[model samples]
Target: MSTSTSTAAADRTLVTALRERLQLDTGEAVSLVETHISWVLLTSRLAYKLKKPVYLGFVDFSTLAARKHFCEEEVRLNRRLAPSLYIGVVAVCGSAQAPHLGEGDPIEFAVCMRRFSEDALLQRLVPAGRLELDRLEQFAHRLASFHGRAQIAAPESEFATPDQVGRPVVDALARLRVDAGARPTRDLQTWIFEQRKALRTAWFARQRSGAVRECHGDLHLANVVLIDDQLTAFDCIEFDPALRWIDVMSDVAFLTMDLEAHGRRDLAFRFLDAYLQHSGDYAGMQVLRFYEVYRALVRALVGRFRVRAGAAQPGGPDYLACATRLARMPNSAPRLMLTHGLSGSGKSTMAAALLAVAGAIRIRSDVERKRLFGLEPHERSIDHPTNIYSREATERTFARLAECARTALQAGYPVIVDAAFLRRDERLLFRALAAQLHVPFSILRCRAGEADLRRRIVAREAQGRDPSEATLDVLERQLATQEPLDPGECAAVLDVATDAPVDVDALGARWLALSLPPITRRPAGWSAS
Candidate 1:
C-alpha cells in the first residue's frame, strides 16, 4: 500500500475506535493530528491526547511502559492548574476491532482533558479586544499565589542550578544551530548564551532567597484559559522536574513574553506589575528581559526543530514566524511612582488604590519598620525613646523603603512608597534614589482638614487595627514638626483631598501616562519580548 493509503487507514481506524469505544459521538466531525510524541483528537466536549511511540533524546515514550508513565505524569502535573479540567489518564486496550477504555490489558495510554471555548484563550481574547488590564492583574495575582504554594526542592537538589534547569533549552538551541548553519545559529546561540549567563546569577539568588521552586515550566498564553470568568493555566511541563524547578520570575516572564507576542504589551505590563506587588520579590526585574528573550528563543528553536524533523505539518512556518517576531522585539523598563503625605492623611488608601490600578508594588514605611523590628504590623513598641518610631528607626525604615523601591523598579516594575514624608530630608532620599535608578518618580499627597485628621487618628486608636501608633497627642506633635515642601519636593506632588471621593484610578492613569515611555507603534508583524 502507498504511504497515503496507510496513513488514511490508520486515521480511520482511530476515528472509528474513538466513536465506538470511547463513546465519542462526534457525528461527522472528526479530526486527528499526529505530532512527534502524541496523537491529539479534538472532540465535542473534550480533547483526548494520547502519547505516540517515539523516542526524543530528553523524552522517551517509545515503549508502552514509558508512554503510560508520561500519561500519568501529564495528569498529575496538569491537575495543579486545572484540577477540574484535567480529568484523568485512562488505558486503551484490545484490538482496533473492539477497542475498550480501561478494560482488559492496556495497549495505549490517553489523557482526557476538558475542552475550553476557543475564544477563551488569551491568544484569541487579545485580538478580540476583550482582554482587560484588570483581568490580567487578577491572573497575575493568581499565578503568584500558585507559585508561592508550589513545592520548593532543597538547595542540594540536582535541579537547583541554571545549567540543570536550562539544559533542554541549551540542547535544543545547539541542535537548531547545527541544522540551520552559522548565521542564524550564531545569532541565536549568542542570545541564548547571554541569557543563560544571567539566568545563572538569577538561579543562585533565588536559591539563596528561597525563590527557587517548582513552577509552571511552560507558562505561555495558550496554556491559560478563561472559563467561567476564571483563568486556568494548563499543560505544564511534566516530563522533567528540572525544567519546572526554576526561579519564579522565569515562570512569570514566559507569560509576559506570551502576552507581548500576542500584541498586548499593556496587559503584559499589568500582569508583571500585579505579580511583583503580591510576591514582593523586586530582584526579579534584573533578569526578566533576559528570561523573556530566552523563552521566545526556546519556542522559536522548538518550532524550527519540529519543521526539520518532519513532525510538524506544512504551514508550521507561521508558528516559527510568531516565535521569531517575539525574539526580535526590544525590552522596555517599568515606570515608578512615589507617595508622600502625613500620617492619617490617607496615603495608604491612595497607595493601595494606585497599586490596584497601576499594578505597582506598594512599599509602606510602617509595615517595613514593623517587619524590621520582628513585630506584627499593629504591634506597638514603647520600650525606649530610640526603639519606637524614633530617629534611628525612622532612618532605617526610609532606607529600607528606598532599597525595596530600587529593587522593584530595577525589575521593570513601578513602585509606590507609602510614607509620611513630612520632612525635606526624608523626601530627598527617595528622589535621589529614583534619580540614580533613572526611573520616573512622582509623589501623591493626601491632604485633609485638621479636624478630619484628628477624627482619623481617633478612629484609628479606637479601632486598634492600624499599624500606626499615632494618637491625638502624637498627631499634634507631628503637625508642629511637619516641614513645608521644598521646590524640588513641590515639583513631584499630586495633591489629593481626603474629604471627597478621590479619583485614584484617574490619578494613577495620568501618572503612568506622563511617566511611562510612549507605547511605540509595533511594526507590521511585530511580536513582543
Candidate 2:
C-alpha cells in the first residue's frame, strides 16, 4: 500500500492506542488535534506531536527511522525559541495495535512538549483583546534576540537566494489560481514577475552577506504563545532547511503579514518598528515587502486548502486580498522625515513613535554605522567619534543612510532618516533626495533642556545598553558645530521636545493630514486583486 493509504489505517490504530496509553482519569477526556501534517495529542500537562508518515516534497517522514530523526530535530530546533516547552523525543515502544508509552523496542517516535493554556496562544489573544500594541513591542524585542543567536546559514546555502525565496510565492499563486479562480490575481502575479529583477538584486546581496540564518520559519500567531507570562515561539521548521534557513527579515515578515491579514495594520506597524529598532536591519526593507507579499500568498493558499477539505475557517481568503494589495505598489504618499538633534535628545525614540504611526521604515546612523563594520546594534568595541565614528566613517554612515532611504522610498514606503542632521549639508542631502523623488519632506527637530540632555547621557552611560556611544563631550561638540536650520526649511519643520511625555498620535494625525490625503475612492482600472 502507498504511504498515504497505509498511514490512514495506521493512524486510526495509533490514535486508539495513544488514547489509552495517555491513561487519563476515568472522568476526564482525551482530545486529539489533527492537521494536514501531524497529529497532536493533549494529555493534561503534556502534548505529544506525532508526525504523519507521509512524504511531502518539502518534508519526508515515510519510514520509522525518518520519523525518529525528524522528531529529534524538531525538539532541538524548537528549543532555541521555545526553550522551556520542548521536552524531548519519545518512542512509541510497542506495536500500533497495543502501543506502550515508554517501555519496549521502538515502533514510532513522537515529540513531547510541555502544554500551556490555549488562551496564551496569540491567535486566541488577538481575538479576545488581550494582545495590545505595547505587548507586541515587547514581543518584538524578544524575537529579535532569538534571531540574534540563531545559527547563521552555511556559506553556500541558497535557501535565501531569490530563486528559492520566490519559489514558494510562485507555487502559492499557482494554487490560488487553480483553487480560487485565475481571473482575480492575474495582475498581481504579473507585477511580481516583472519586478523580480529589482527584488533579486537587492535581497540576494543580503543572503550573500550572511543575513540568512536558521529562523523560526512558521512564525504566524498560532505557533506563538505567552507561556509563564512570557511571549514565546514554538513548532519551528525542522524537516526542511529551505523553510528554516532564510533572511532574518523573512522570519519577521511572517508575523507582520499575519497581523495585516487580520486587519491590524497599526499593530503590524508597531511590531515592525520595534523589531527594526532593536535589530537595525534597515537595509532589509527591500526584502521585507517582497517576503510579506509572499507570506500573505502562502497563508491565503493554506486557508484555501483547509476549506477544500471542509475546514472552512472564519477568516476566508482575506490574505488573497492582502497578497495582491502588497504585491502592487501602494498608493503611498511617500515622504522623508529626517531627525535633527544633539545626541541623547531622543531622536531614535521620536523616530520610533513616528514609525508606528506612519508605517515608515527608519534608518538609524548609530545602528547602521556599527552594522557597516560587522557589529551587532548593541555591541561596542570602541568609543564614539574615535574609531567607527571618525569624520570619514560618519560620511560613509550618512551615505549608507541616504542610499537605504532612497531604496525604501522607491519601493513605496514613507521613510524616516534617524540621525543627528546636525549639519545643513546633512539635512540638504535628504531634502534634495525627497525633491528628486517628488515626495513631501519634513524635518523633526528634537530638543531638550541642556540639563535633561546631560542627565540622559549620564544615565545612558551608566546602563551602557544604547547603541549611540555619545558622550557629554560629543554632545557639546554637536551643539557647537550644529548648523541652524535654514529659513527655507521652516515650512517643513516639526519641533518636538523629547524630555517629557506627549501624545504621539496628536502630532501624527497633524502630519498625516498634511502629507497623506485620505483615499476617497479607488483609481481607474482597479480590481480587488
TM-score of each: 0.72, 0.85
TM-score of 1: 0.72
Alpha-carbon error at 255 in model 1, in Å? 0.6
lDDT of 1 at 48: 81
Q: How many angstroms is residue 291 displaced in model 2 relative to the true structure, after the best TM-score fit?
A: 1.2
- Candidate-wise lDDT, in order: 0.71, 0.81
The best candidate by lDDT is: 2
Which tens-of-lDDT digit does each residue in 1-529 have in candidate 1? Answer: 9966775466458546865544544455645666666777766787788876656676777577987898898898888878998999987778666666667888677898887787898767877888766677778877888887988878777665777656766665665567643224455556666667756876777787777788889988778889768788888887777778887888998887777666666567667766755665667766676667667667667666666677654532233333444444333235556666666788887776676566566777777787677665556766533475778888888878878887767656667888888887777777666666666667787899888888898888899866678788877887899888766557667889987898876887777765522432222232221
Give the runs in model 1 whose Cα sits over 4 Å from its true position.
Answer: 1-16, 23-34, 165-199, 302-337, 342-399, 409-420, 423-425, 435-482, 491-529
**Inter-residue clash pairs, candidate 2:** none
